[model samples]
Target chain A: MDKRAIGVFDSGLGGLTAVRRLHALMPQENIIYFGDTGRVPYGTRGRDIITKYARQDVAFLRQFDLKSIIIACNTVSAIALDLLSKENDIPIIGTVEPACRRAMTMTQTGRVGVIGTAATIRSGAYEKYLHKKDGTLDLFTQACPLFVPLVENGRVHRGDVVIETVVKEYLTPLKDAGVDTLILGCTHYPLLEEVIGDFMGPDVTLIDSGAEAANLASTQFDPNEGTGTTQYFVSDDPQGFNQLAELFLQEKVDVGAELVDISRY
Target chain B: MDKRAIGVFDSGLGGLTAVRRLHALMPQENIIYFGDTGRVPYGTRGRDIITKYARQDVAFLRQFDLKSIIIACNTVSAIALDLLSKENDIPIIGTVEPACRRAMTMTQTGRVGVIGTAATIRSGAYEKYLHKKDGTLDLFTQACPLFVPLVENGRVHRGDVVIETVVKEYLTPLKDAGVDTLILGCTHYPLLEEVIGDFMGPDVTLIDSGAEAANLASTQFDPNEGTGTTQYFVSDDPQGFNQLAELFLQEKVDVGAELVDISRY
Candidate 1:
């Protein structure tokens, strides 16, 4: 049984949601996480920049012996996954395809709503994967650009009027389209599930893309008996990441984080 | 007669406010501006990272034959100005000192309020400069972390509900302190002048830090007119910057923009 650590990374702290999911699915697998807090919110950036950053992120993770890499950032998954997968042999998993597959199965009606960062929505990666599975599926996509910052700043509670207002602004059109299954296309979006759920009402089923990808990764690997450990690395100062990481992961990152000059990779 | 272009750069499009000021103050001076759009919002990042990014930004601008360089971003000015000044023989101007000097003159009650990004506020650069000028002056500082994103997203209108709510949340304490002059310490804040002015009322005279810096830069330079022209460069794609640039500049950037991969420099 190969037991090299799984490398998971995001533009920022949101990827910890995927780590949380992996913990539930495979408790004995080692995880190495890198968050590019120095240059974050990849959702708003251009495609080339995202690809370059993703390449750097993967290269940084490759410093350690890694069996696989999981791109927990939806923006990177949408824009840079194919190129990144080809660059390395370690089976790279993106948060888009597995999520599309789950949404395909979960939908009662053919209608599916997708909400994510501007780049993720713009990439049309989810639609491409969803259409590949079933040609007849009706897809709706919305780019909620401000959601990441709102969630990152801890404005994601159930009753935060500001967040609720923003949720309504983004989800009302999707709700009106009568989509039965909605994909929380960005990992950070799941943090606002309560507010999103309240606005979308009980009829729509929301899929956490990061969690689905984590589950897919867990199923692909063989779990080892060694105690599961998490190592955290960030491009920014460790203190800032440590402070905000609580909002993303259920458990404290057992291994304290260290700073890395991500540009070198 | 100095005819070389004056180089000004910011973490993002916000620095265009300074360019706008320069255009008005010295109509016959050629200007070169670089915005690190791919890695924008240096205000949220750590000091060393900001310094590194600022150095790269300055280095990128140095590609042009520049007479002087303006640190139009308050975060960079607050954290990286001295280092950048030491590194370059070109006269380096920062936003903090100019704005503080203006506020010292504008405040009748000696009660001044400052609002900016977390890094800018944390640097305490404004307070330090202001205290050095007049030790008895009262200062109230608040870090409005969300303002940059809100402005960048074009949510800066006077009656925009989201921005108004956030403005109240951030400025109420400053108002309560009975401050007569408030410094719009970050360049982006000037875009929200209407909303901020509405919230603070006419009495709280707001000092635009970027404008002050631009004015300072304009005063220092001797203008020799062939023809005043503007050239723009960005770390990300030119298309994205071109799209959002109208929000910052009074007139269209006449020379258009070119993309530069900032990491190389």
Candidate 2:
């Protein structure tokens, strides 16, 4: 039995969805979360920048003496996970692999749809993983870059005209491609599930990346009582981070967030 | 006559709108631009984070021996410009004061509206400046955070249903408030000008923050030969930076962008 905290991080507060799930599954395991609030929305950026930021994020969590690290941002999970694992000694898990495995299991028709940030979709990480698992599966990918900012700004709802219209535009291509299962490729996309569900109709199955990652974390749980306390850190704006935590966890957590110079990591 | 480059920066590619104008207005002046592409969307973040990132951006540009600096991001200009200026020796200009000054001049009915990122609106910098300029003028403000990500991803045509719908949702409140003039308080908002114009109606004048900052940059122009060239630097993907540059400038520029370690600053 060991008691080290589980380290989870994302480009922003979206990763709290995973933290929320982890809390439910492993109630006693401590968590250390770092959201790069200052430089967020990592999905639309280039591969090199995403990799650099991911390394810094992992390094920040490493300082907490974490037993394992979870790269919760889909864009980073897709592009930088392999590089990060090679650089760190701890057990590292990214949202992409576990979510892809879950999607493969859920899909009966072997046809899948993926929606994420421009960079994540462009990386073809999901498609690559799915193809490696079954070589015959069909993949449809769409880049919904605006989804992150829209959800973060609290414009997510089934009846919200603006978000509804944008969701329709983004999902139309995927729906037309005739996929039976859709992966909410980015963690933030889960917040817009109601809007996405309305647009995709009832036939499509939705996969949540954060939920899958949480499931994976539960399987690898090391039951130890001494090291399971949760801690939170941010690169910028602790107040804004606290506010977004409410949306992800569906509860307000009053963790006095500390700002650290992320560049040094 | 100074031969040093005029340094300009933003949290991301939004500042390219100002750089585009500067290129047209002063063909001979050297330009050094830095866009923190990896950690962008500074408008939604908090003030302290914006200040820290802005300082690093400024310090990164200082390596080029810049004669002047322009903070083309409205959120940063509103919250961190004074702090950033005090941290650097170079002459610094920000979009807020220039855009606010222009808005004060353009409003005929004494009722002006401002739309920007949440942080910019929350700071109330434009409202304070407009009131200071003419106490009788009425100010209305709203935060349209998704506009930047939408513009960055190129969903910005007047005929684009998604953009038009989002624009309507963002502008309906300001339109109801009955303001004769509106400030596009963020530099990225200029890309959505056509959609915003259709939503707000032609009667309400729109102020482009980047254009105002460009006009301000013109006032500091030095008439020296061969010292003016555009040099671009970024913290992350130079390829994504160049692509965004094409969208904001609408003209292809062969800008050889170099990557810099911005967190050090």
Candidate 3:
């Protein structure tokens, strides 16, 4: 019954995939999205830094009257979600938990493969969550740090030679580990699903973290209450946000992003 | 002889290549390097945002009483170097002009290739500089935006299938044009030189922009006059900065980096 906007933030434009889902599922609830375009690819960074940045990101979004906050960046979700949830008053949902739940439902062999930034892999969030869901599940983890930059730079296409090459290299280890299900651990990894799909073959199921988070958000919030509008915000450049979002959403996003001084938060 | 440290700044660790060259040529000069690792990958952003960030980066170094400043980022050099030079009293040198000069000298067939970030290529600074030097030089330009991310993520080695594939895709047009000399217009590109070299074949000479900038700086300043001490500073994550620099520099960067709040500048 709440009409307030749901706040969502990511390291970069990959969160637009979540925004797209929110828009489709909750057309009546307002959405606030912030992409830290300036200081992106948070997955490669250290835990403390990611936590610090995530705090700032959430604090910035808090300036608006947000009902809930979504930590759309997987690295942040893995390392800082609990800290953020404990610190903030609003319901802070990270993509990790929701995506892990979805992965649990989709796995057949109980062997799950997870790919994300180095920090995410190091955190072992996916393995811990999958094991919690099913004690018998075997987890295979691979850190694909290059995927974020590749996606940000508009190399998400299936035939993109660079993406295809990197995907193969990243997936080979997990493929050899004989995992039946693969989790695109980072929000940005969904954009490379085609290349990843080709590398893992048809047998492996690809779980999109952003999509899972969006689905969870949809279940929690009632969409038919009112017409929900999306407001975009960025810490740095707002110019390329729309262009980058187009790749993820597969549609042109006309949303005008306001620039926010995230450091102030 | 002036003994003040030369200030060098980049969006991130890519500038270490310039620092590496400076260490080799001017071993005695004290160097102050500021990597905006917290808010890095300035290439894909807009000119105004890049200019603003570049100014803040320069200001951070100014606090150290620097003798000169090197704009190691190609996007900054291409778009904001002149603006920064006007604003600062200290001598400011950028990679663009020196790299362009070096490219002009190395191109044997008049057909020259330029590869950099999207913003760098869009600015057409190298093309303008090349034409200014010799109007007859045929310039071929391609924006290899993912190269920086690949380099930063430690995917730069030769025969690394991912980097090699990306290099081949990015260099195909220039290779088809029979470019005799290719300018690695961004500092990060130098890290991927091995893969770039393999893709471009042995005939094409690769111009490392950061190296040229260092050589230019060396000619103007005597490294022997300083204390040979180097200090590293970053906007966020000093530990990540140290690790990335060590990885990129291919040696232990003994100088500890201080985390400074760069947004203030």
Candidate 4:
């Protein structure tokens, strides 16, 4: 049984949703989370830059004796996970494969809709993974570039006009395709589930990638071995991250985040 | 007479607005622009991180024999201008001082409104600069955090429901305060001028800080010194910047952007 802490990182606080789920599933496992708040919103950026930042994020976590590393960010997972897994010895798992697998099981109609940042949708990572599992599976993909900013700005309420308008603009195409299973392809996308779900109607099943990834991590480790310790680290102002932590985790972050100069990595 | 190119940089393509204005005011001036596209949107980040990025942006421009340097991004101008100006021997000018000066001359009622990113409004740089100039002047400031993302996503058309809703939400406070002159404090705001202008109505004179900064730069040197050459540089994928350049510059960005590894700075 590996007793070491599990390392998790995201472009920003969105990864904490995964951590919250991880805590629920494996209460005793020690978790160390790093949010790259300084250089965030990786979904809108280029693949190479995201990959570079992901490497730095992994290196920062590698300093700790981690049982495993989770790429909680969908953007990093889509763009950098293979490179990171190949380069490092530690077990590195990205959200895409786990969540795709979850969707494959959840979908009865073989019709799946994937929504994420531009790079993620453009990379077609989710579709590729799903196709590899079953070539007959039908996939519809949409890039909701503004979703991250909307979520980050706390505009995810049920009746928010802006959120509703933007959501409709992105999801209508997927809905038109008659996709029964919708993948919240970005970590931050889960925060806007209520609005997205309302638009997609009650009949459609919404898959939370971060939560699925957490569940995937749960199966890999022995729950009885850990100490239940959790620490938060960020590359920007701790004060700001501390204030926004609750928005992501759905509870006040117990420990104040410690700031680290991530550029050093 | 300085024959060297004038340097201008922003966290992203928003500074191209300043470059566009510079081209108009001084048609013959050679301009060198650097947009940190890899790590754009510094306005939402902490002061120290903004300062660090501003330094790297300046250092990248300093490599060329520059006649002067312009901090076209309002966030960097608000947070790092004074520090950057003091640290470097080259003439460094930020948009705040020039825009504030312009507003001073334009406002007949002495009531001025300022709108920008969270960091810019939080820093109170425009208010401080305006107050320092005339203590009796009344100022109303609002932080429009979503504006940058909206503009970057190309949601700037007049009567666009999302743009109108966001504009009203951010501008109503300023409009209620009865400010006749409004300062588009951030460079990106100028792109949404039509939507913003419609919301504020015809009487409220909108001030583009970026345009004003370009005018200010034009006055500092002889027009005949430059050869009408302009070049663009970015920290991330040039192809992405190349696609978005026209949105900011109004015209085609001739000679595609050159990539620079900004972390070295």
- Per-candidate interface DockQ score: 0.76, 0.72, 0.58, 0.86
Report lDDT (CA) for all predictions: 0.91, 0.85, 0.85, 0.91
Q: After superposition, how far is residue A40 of candidate 1 from its true place, in Å?
A: 0.5
Fill in the DockQ of model 2: 0.72
C-alpha displacement of A120 in model 4, angstroms? 0.5
> Model 4 segments beyond 4 Å from truth?
none
TM-score of 1: 0.98
User: Which of 2 and 3 is ahead in DockQ?
Assistant: 2
DockQ of 1: 0.76
Clashing residue pairs in candidate 2 (N, C-alpha, C atoms within 3 angstroms): A3-A227, A30-A228, A30-A229, A39-B39, B29-B228, B30-B228, B30-B229, B31-B229
Order the numbered candidates by TM-score, best leading: 4, 1, 2, 3
Interface RMSD of each: 0.9, 1.8, 2.2, 0.7
Worst 10 residues of 4 chain A by lDDT: A247-256
Each candidate: RMSD = 1.1, 2.3, 2.5, 1.0
How much lDDT does candidate 4 score?
0.91
| Candidate 3 Cα outliers beyond 4 Å, as residue runs | A131-134, A159-161, B201-203, B244-247, B250-253
- Model 4 DockQ reads 0.86
Q: What's the TM-score of each model vs. the native? A: 0.98, 0.93, 0.92, 0.99
Native contacts present in each candidate (fraction): 0.60, 0.95, 0.72, 0.78
